[model samples]
Target: MKQSLLAARYFNTTAEEAMDGLIASATPRQYLISVQDGTSLRVRIWSEIGLEEAQMGELLDWLRGVQGDIRSIQSGSTNAHDHASVVEKWVAERHGIADLFLEQLDPTTSSKADMEPELSLGVLGGRTVMISTNTLMFSRLQEGVFGLSIAQRGSYLIEQLRRA
Candidate 1:
């Protein structure tokens, strides 16, 4: 298997800038979205483990496909549940999907913040990318600030990423 990734870096950028980078690099083949009550957004992006970013149009198309898949969600489907079978199916075919990372979020915590926006949940692969305003946070490694070297993560993290 390829190396696992650990992207817990912190970049001092605005939320919008963070999203821009995340969107540009994301190449989600399949994804699930879930909400609690009427609020809270969580999205789990499924893709190849070390997947490369698609070109602009390709990324846009890929996003459209994800949206299309999301629309197909059953009446009670969500990113966490209602898609257990589907999640299992995808993960089985793509072990690289285990490389889960967060983006466009306030890692200090998930609570809603002052003017800044946060992406409740984000799952991604490839090189680590993290954008944040807090300087006190971030655990760097040999790879870099956001680079967590999946090759070193424990089985628990990998299993948890797959399970989620």
Candidate 2:
């Protein structure tokens, strides 16, 4: 099997800015959205992605209307391990979906290093973060399908968020 290299980029931003940047650049419907009891929003955003600043504000306002406390963006930890741990929990829990599709898959069978580092974006503590353990922003190593270098998608995402 061709092993993927670990790649990641860290940024200090809000979920709205990050999501806006991602949605504007991403393919249609590649992302998924889940709201937790109208208290928190969980988006399974695609790695490859933005909206305009004004539109973004409006969209966030709508979310806030439905999900209270959506604007009190708190700061998140910069520690990568903490982020990884959060991912681990998410996988293990699978939000109660594991029994349906991943019944045979054991979360313990995979180590953090062994898992395919997926692209993820979220507000850790308060700050927004974008990361992919197996994507390279810049590298001479093996290129991905469609000529993408390691974390090419994630690299594009961070840049877009910063610009937004």
Candidate 3:
């Protein structure tokens, strides 16, 4: 068995900015990127708000630039739920189906613990792209700001399944 290798790193930006930058520079082969928030405690208190639709569109456009076809955007965090709804509306308006993956987390928990590192992937018309996120920290590692760790985990998994 070939062990999967990950090229993970700590980014020096807010989670949103890191996500935006990754989406902007995405490649069709790169579907998911893990994000970590690396802001000071004070900055985090002020930057908890999520991204807007227009901002999402800008990010989507960036993804499209890299041959990425995003069918939907899902949020697994409470703070990002509203933003996910907004993005879903935008995608629906554009005739794309959007969904929020918020159900995966327990809502009763505090936002801090609930908003751990999340995994989201870009799908092209129902066909999932090869990508996913692992268990990781978002706030502490990234300083409570937006941070991202991109790896080819999905592709590796897919390849392994194919061989099996």
Candidate 4:
């Protein structure tokens, strides 16, 4: 029954404005915020947390509660938005596990030796789920400063899962 304030969502707001809202909603809790850029309806402020003191399976259950679908894009997966339906169907019907690995490559990094990559790790329906994104985009956890360890482990994990 314990959950952390992982995200404070406000569609179509700037990063600074999102921070202000986050401060108002959940003060004193340090949050890594991301704003979906451009003129479209963006997350004026979306946040996340990592390594909360919760049971292993609880995190996935919590994600389901908040991001069971697109309407619950308050937090959890980046798929909480546009990809909600696909993710929902996948989770509900237990469809092809081989189709889960996907990422949106930022055009800037489309041709680079080392790109701005972001990785997020979490449990989904008691399963270990991993996602990759650009560093400027959203993440599963509020871990901007802590990306190093997550990236290292994420790489290894993806490799292992691929082999499996």
Q: Give the 10-residue window scoring lowest on summed lDDT in candidate 3.
A: 153-162
- After superposition, candidate 3 runs with Cα above 4 Å error: 7-109, 112-114, 135-164
The lDDT, on a scale of 0 to 1, for candidate 1 is 0.31
- Residue-level lDDT of model 3, residues 1-164, one tens digit each, is 11222322222132334344434543322112222354221101111224355634544454342222122221222233333232233222222322111112222446644443223333222222212245321211221122222232211110111124
For each candidate, give its TM-score against the true structure: 0.24, 0.19, 0.23, 0.22
| Model 2 stretches astray by more than 4 angstroms | 1-74, 95-164
lDDT scores in order: 0.31, 0.27, 0.27, 0.26
* 3 against 4, candidate with superior TM-score: 3
In candidate 2 the C-alpha lDDT for residue 52 amounts to 38
lDDT of 3: 0.27
Better of 1 and 4 by TM-score: 1
**Which candidate would rank higher by TM-score, 1 or 3?**
1
- Name the runs in model 4 displaced over 4 angstroms: 1-90, 94-100, 118-128, 131-164
Between candidates 2 and 3, the one scoring higher on TM-score is: 3
Candidate 2 lDDT tens digits, 111-147: 5334332323232222223222232221111111111
Q: With candidate 2 superimposed using the best TM-score fit, by how many Å does residue 156's alpha carbon deviate from the native?
A: 14
